[model samples]
Target: MNISTYRQLIPSPVALVTGANKGIGFEISRILAESGIFVWMAGRDSARIKEATASLKKAGLPVDAISLDVTDPQSVESAAQHVQTVSGALDILVNNAGIVNERRLNKAGEPEVIPPSQIELNTLRQTYETNVFGVFTVTKAFLSLLRKSPAGRIVNMSSGLGSLTQRSDPNWAYSVVNALAYCSSKTAVNGITVAFAKELKDTPIKVNAADPGYCATDLNGHSGPRTPTQGAEIAVRLATLPEDGPTCGYFDENGPVPW
Candidate 1:
């Protein structure tokens, strides 16, 4: 924390977090910026992205709103190109954009038949398109910039519901919270994180999957246990890992979660 050490580090280290217009992503942007990082608030909606950046700016945070639609290849490439020109290197990448459709009802305790059979295929696909595929596209687009950094960090925003160990165990807390599309998509995100981590095993990047736990956000109708502030803690921690930090792992705020 000394002046010399701080000066040796990258001034205003750049961070890109997708789906940051609101909820957990927004909180992550705020927290990172507050910690002296230049945050790139990425989202699909133009106005929301501006609003997110404006709100953070009002708080005296250094944040830039960027249009990033994870599922759209053209949009991802364009955004990546812009970031390359401006920052030249991406120090941290938080893939926090995710979606769920099992809202408006107490489906958390519902039977398996209800969530899978009752929900439409289109709904399932739409959820995956946002939660899973979006993360892949965004990560792929920014991997090079991240590699250029001395201490690169990639925090894949995953969930506890994605844990197969929890799902298989009948006594586990997340076992009853059944939603095929949503949970499975997170599982895919975890797998993708592992794959990328393996590829960059010898590099300086510290890639890990972080579960924000249950947060009160629009995705779940704001009925979750924690607030967005509480949820952003782990995402920021994983994003700021040192050169010797662990990689290809899954963790919440307190510690690692069961995979």
Candidate 2:
């Protein structure tokens, strides 16, 4: 089914999307707003947030700017409180905020690539700070508001490189694309997704990880084949799942991806 069809399943739900100033997060925010949902486009940069909000507003989307740095506890708390004060509750959250690598890639048309054995410990820590810990911190802060919603959904933006199963396959296309910091961080995201899903099994909340499938975004030096909007499809799907939908799973646009 297309995005328009999926939008019909979810209408007027309030959502918060981190890293929404650009790339897949921005596209996801746009899609959500276009679906009649009230979107909080959260980002760390005030200038980028303003520009993004203006661009979306110009396109007639219902979105508001929010300053949020997922790695900062105080920022996460403040953003959650703001959402609560304004919307009363949150129906959806897209944990799309993340980092690729600590070492900047200077080579044109190439992404940050480094061997696992040679990876720096500090780099790994930095990657996990945003990709893993940030998810936990933000989700915990928003649990109260999420619980109040009739149907609550949490979508963790993961990646195909995180798949241990796929990584082990020699024929896998991304097998040679190993980068310890970013890849392992997403693996932790998958584990985190299941942990929350299990804890909230009996509750109204559902948690799932999404693989955007190498979208051509700043995250990967714009080398990925898919468009940002296409990359957001799986995330949007999980974000708007029905009450009876599956949780504690990894998925892409087509269907479930191997863990």
Candidate 3:
């Protein structure tokens, strides 16, 4: 059935998740749909997104696909337009697309540490293109739709590595795995979350950041101990938060995360 027909049946809240073709993003999309929200699973690859949506459809979930490349302004605008034309309003938005380029693998195939001082400027720029700028672009594009909702929510996927407090602690477990580009980009995401939350404080819309706690995904070469489904729990919770839920905050599964 078409999106309109599906909406007619469920008529529930609507959500859009970026980079939802696989890994943590896919799990987030799955969880949101399972919760009765009509999900727009977006990704850079058209084929991948189609496949991802298909899997959800087979499971009898309310979902559709959107081809979105977070780094491209035109693509983002087009996606916003499509949503406007179809859903008219969006209730939740999860910015889950991100990348890591400064990491490498040794002969043992384990993650090799790259010192922050040695990270290339270009690598940082590339990382920000998807992780930082993409969040800004997609959020700006969808803010209008979100405002139309009675209670809008924004969930930005972040990482514990982005925490300045945790990173500064010499005893931090992952301190030795310093990846400047990836970690700093997530830090910027938290800042963006706070900025938007403050700006819309009086509105019904709530904005928050989620730390997935190093899930095993392609971004980290599948090295994390946590499963993608486990990582998606916090983001799904943030996206479906109640009107009285906290905003402008960073949280993990347990609770608040250090900034």
Candidate 4:
């Protein structure tokens, strides 16, 4: 709940956060750094990673700037090597790098959908390439390091729109903006989290999908209901879970979200 409590809970653990240059990822990195972990601020742009790490450092938080493009295998491999060089293992892997290439403000007044006829296949493919495939690439690249920790945590940044329960409900709040590409990409993330958790059921690795709620970030044109700091709570919590914390689960800021 507080920085002091987080420090008491975890001391000097190594954590890698993707897309840490801004938004919820930035806030998550800040909070984790405040908790005494060496937060690796990872991003595609080398300058951005440096800026983010520097900003946190300026704020008196321990952070390291690391270049990582989740979509690029070479970049992910290089980042993994960086983690290995700093520490023998990685304790936390926050898959926060994601993209949503669709209509942000639906112009249909009420319920809106990307016109089926006009929906660009490239857009959907690109979203999947990042939101879905990129996560797998980064996690797999770092899982070896995570395995060395006593309690390894992998937190996938997802959204409520990923929930099949909500998607199926005709009256759901998110039903208005049916951006299939973005929504389905998140769903794929949730699936990946579950599959990873199941595969590691007997190990110390804990994998879970986290919904940040509607956070006001560049991804959403800052039109969300919550702040990035508030949006990052669940992600940070999942990434720092103790041995007894939930695994193979879907959670939001408040509690478990219906799958």
Off by over 4 Å in 4: 2-10, 104-113
Q: List candidate 1 stretches off by more than 4 Å.
A: 1-9, 103-114
> Worst lDDT window (10 residues) for model 3?
1-10
TM-score of each: 0.92, 0.93, 0.94, 0.93
lDDT of each: 0.87, 0.89, 0.90, 0.87
- TM-score: which is higher, 2 or 4? 2
Model 4 residue pairs with clashes: none
lDDT of 1 by residue, 49-136 (tens): 9998998899899999999998898999999999999999998899999888754435576323235767788878888888888888
* Tens-digit lDDT track of model 4 for 43-107: 99999789878877888888889998888999999989988988889988999999877653366
Residues 58-170, candidate 3, lDDT per residue (tens digit)? Answer: 99999999999999999999999999999999988999998889876778987675778887899999999999999999999999999998888899998998898998888
Candidate 1 at residue 194, lDDT? 96
Error of 1 at 141 (Å): 0.6
Q: By lDDT, who's the top model here?
A: 3
Backbone collisions counted per model: 0, 0, 0, 0
Can you rank all candidates by lDDT, best first?
Answer: 3, 2, 4, 1
| lDDT pick, better of 1 and 3 | 3
Q: lDDT of model 1 at residue 227?
A: 97
